[model samples]
Target: MIISVRVQQILLLLTLLVIGISREIIQLELWALPLALLSGLVLQGIGDSKRRRKWNIASVTISCLSLCLLLRTQNPYVLFYAIFFTVLSKFLIVYKGQHFFNPTNFGIVVCLTVFPNLSWVSPGQWGNYFFPSLALSVIGVLVARNAQRLLTAFSFLSFYSLMLLTRYLYLGDPLSIFTHQLKSFSLVIFCFFMITDPRTTPRSFKGQILYTFLIALTGYLLQFHFYIREGLFYALFFICLLNPLINKLFPAKEYQWAKKI
Candidate 1:
């Protein structure tokens, strides 16, 4: 059976949602994915068209493999559904697939609210998971993948570090926030997964940098105030909220929104 591009996306999304819910990593109970899937069905009627090979391959390669290999997850079911819900939400939310919010992060939020007990694991402790991100960057380049990936990642991470450093100084905590920042699973995952979401993040170099820094700053505040482990997820969502209206004081062409034909 042939699948259309859009249809494939919807299926992939619901599949990942199921995986997340099933893993008990988020708040949703048994029917979490089904709920999201049902919503997609009602809101965006399922379409039938032949799936594009390259797009499917890319989605499967990154989203699927990342779920399985790169992330330091104990859940076996994370990779069960052969789909990517994060990107699927992107298609639904934005026009022409240009987004400033990471779909994966958004999904994490949904999972968090729906299933608070469900955890999004950290991988900074894992050595193997660390360096593969470098590989993904190269692969992203080889496939002509998201261009502003590093810019977005560095901006978010660096600023997030600064926020922590500030808070640690204010709190008089003797522990090194720098090492803590490096060891955080949230930081690792955001740099690799959420910050790199092509649709939600800006395409231009300067824009991505600004967008990333915004996430880091907000995440720091949330963690300091509320102590949310998945503060990065909420931070990314806030940044996405900001990106639509964000205007740079200093103008650069790379920071401009993607041109949609």
Candidate 2:
């Protein structure tokens, strides 16, 4: 039996959530996950009803899981806002029938910018665990491969890693510095899930490669030069603005998800 890519994604995220919660790594309230998931589903249902379309539970759930995993906040209202805008963006922000911004990325960035005091993303929340990182990479690769967005994920990781290595070498730091950075599970999630979102990424292979490069360069600058911890999220958010131009320049067949078996 074959599992749909979206189903695979949901399972993978659920596993990560369980691992994080079990290990006491994810610092979230007991009610936060349910609230995010429920809010996302209900908002998506409302959008579908308004548009006279079917509810996309998979996509909405994925976005909500992303929020629950990455975002940390003391206030429930902030979480609601993040999920609200996350789902709202999918309906309001469209370009030629496609949403350029990754929904979860948009939500995270928005909250970080708008409610910096109340909301934050802990990049180190997952810690530098070897086994979990390896598992994430292996499973993420499979999911990206099935979704046909492996190129986007691989290119982003490669480019981002190169940037880290270059910066470390410039500073005369040991190679371990670079290797340690690669252990960030948050970065892995961003690469495999957020950046590789098929509906949001460039349609053409060339466009996707170029897009990843830009994200890497911008993220590096933001993290190193500007001293921003949440640089990658902002990097993706801003670079997504150029996606329409990227698609226009490197026109190719638009990606369509495989029908559920």
Candidate 3:
């Protein structure tokens, strides 16, 4: 039986939440999750009302969960602002009837940039455990497949992995060093959840492939050359600026959640 893409995303993220909490992998406050949900839902409701559209609870929940999972902050106000801007960006940042910035990504980058002392991202929270990484990959593939953006996810992973491998080869590093980098759960989640976001990604398959390739290349340069830890997020933000042009060049039918799979 096929499931809604949003539903699959929620389930996968919830599973990660449980694992992260139970294993004490993530350093999140107990109140963070509820605050994220409440703020996102309330803000999303207001946005929907303004547009005369029904509220999308699933989408809001997914964004809240993503924020809670990736973003870390001790201040409640910082957390609230993150969720506030995350939901607000959906309504404010639009181009050709679609929002290009992934809401969660936007919020994280905004908070990190604006509140550098209070906010940060912990990419190593998920660790490099083989079994957990595999589980995340399997479920992430299912979610991406349901969203009809599996190719986007895989292409990003492939391109990013190739860059890592090339760098290791150029440095005369061991193959294990390259494989060790590939074991990151944060990278997997970025590939499947953030970059493969249907609304933000290009409609055409070719466009998506090209889009992800650029993201991979930009992220590699930022991480390796500039030494930015959150290079993927920055790369996606920069690449999204060119999304409209990519869509124009490789136009296709826009995706709708209500469309039959």
Candidate 4:
């Protein structure tokens, strides 16, 4: 039987989570995962109830998994608050009919900003495990293919790589520095999963290319110029504010989880 894209996403994220746990990449309290998951589901359920819409367990699962992976916090209450706001943001932060900021990114950013001491984003937490990086890349390609957002993913990575290379040449950085930066596990995940998020991206192919390119350029500036640690996330967050105008200029079709591009 053919699997739904939502199911595919759920499976892929779950697989990544398991691998992360096994490799000790995800070091959190035993209760963190369950608490975060429960919070996401319950909040989402309430949101759906108020909106008189059907509950989507897949969305809840995906958001929670993303939180568990990206966010590192010792406080269960902090995780719960983040997940709670994550679900709540979906309902409150609307543009037309869809949410503008990506749910996972928004939640993580908010918590990080508000509770800087208690919460953190472990960009290098995955380390440079070659095998896991390869596996994640393959899975990301598969997911992007099915989602029809492969172009966006490739565009983002290509532009981002070019920026990195340009910086390396200008700074006269060593080849090893370039290699190390390119092999970042967090960068791979961001390219494949977050940037390729169909719902948040522009509809037309040209729009997506331009959009991803802007994100890459801005991210490069933030990272290299200002020395921001979470440059990619912040770049995406700020750029997403202009998505409405981008969609208006290059409108094609809104993405649907049930439909393959």
Which 10-residue window of candidate 3 scores lowest in summed lDDT? 141-150
What is candidate 3's lDDT per residue for 146-186, written digit by digit as tens? Answer: 44577788889899999998899899998887877999888
Tens digit of per-residue lDDT, candidate 2, span 220-251: 89999999999999999999999999999999
Q: lDDT tens digits, residues 1-261, model 4?
A: 977766888888788888888988888689988898887888888899888999878888888988888889999888998898778768898899888777788888889888999999888888876676777788888766554578887888899989999989989989888878888899888888787777778877778878999999999999889998888988888777777788898888887766655
Model 1, span 1-261: residue lDDT tens = 844333433454354445444654333434434433333333222321222222333333334323332222233233222123554554556643344445555555655565444335453333333344455434333322334655566566667767777767788886654555556443554565556655556655666677777777777767667877667668877778766554344334433324321
State residue 219's C-alpha deviation in candidate 1, in Å: 0.6
Q: Could you tell me every candidate's TM-score relative to the true structure?
A: 0.58, 0.96, 0.96, 0.95
Runs in model 2 deviating more than 4 A are 259-261
Q: How many clashes in each structure? A: 22, 0, 0, 0
lDDT to native, each model: 0.50, 0.88, 0.88, 0.84
Q: How far is candidate 4 from the true structure (C-alpha RMSD, Å)?
A: 1.5
Which residue pairs collide, candidate 4?
Answer: none
Clashing pairs in 3: none
Task: State which candidate, 1 or 4, has the greater TM-score.
Answer: 4
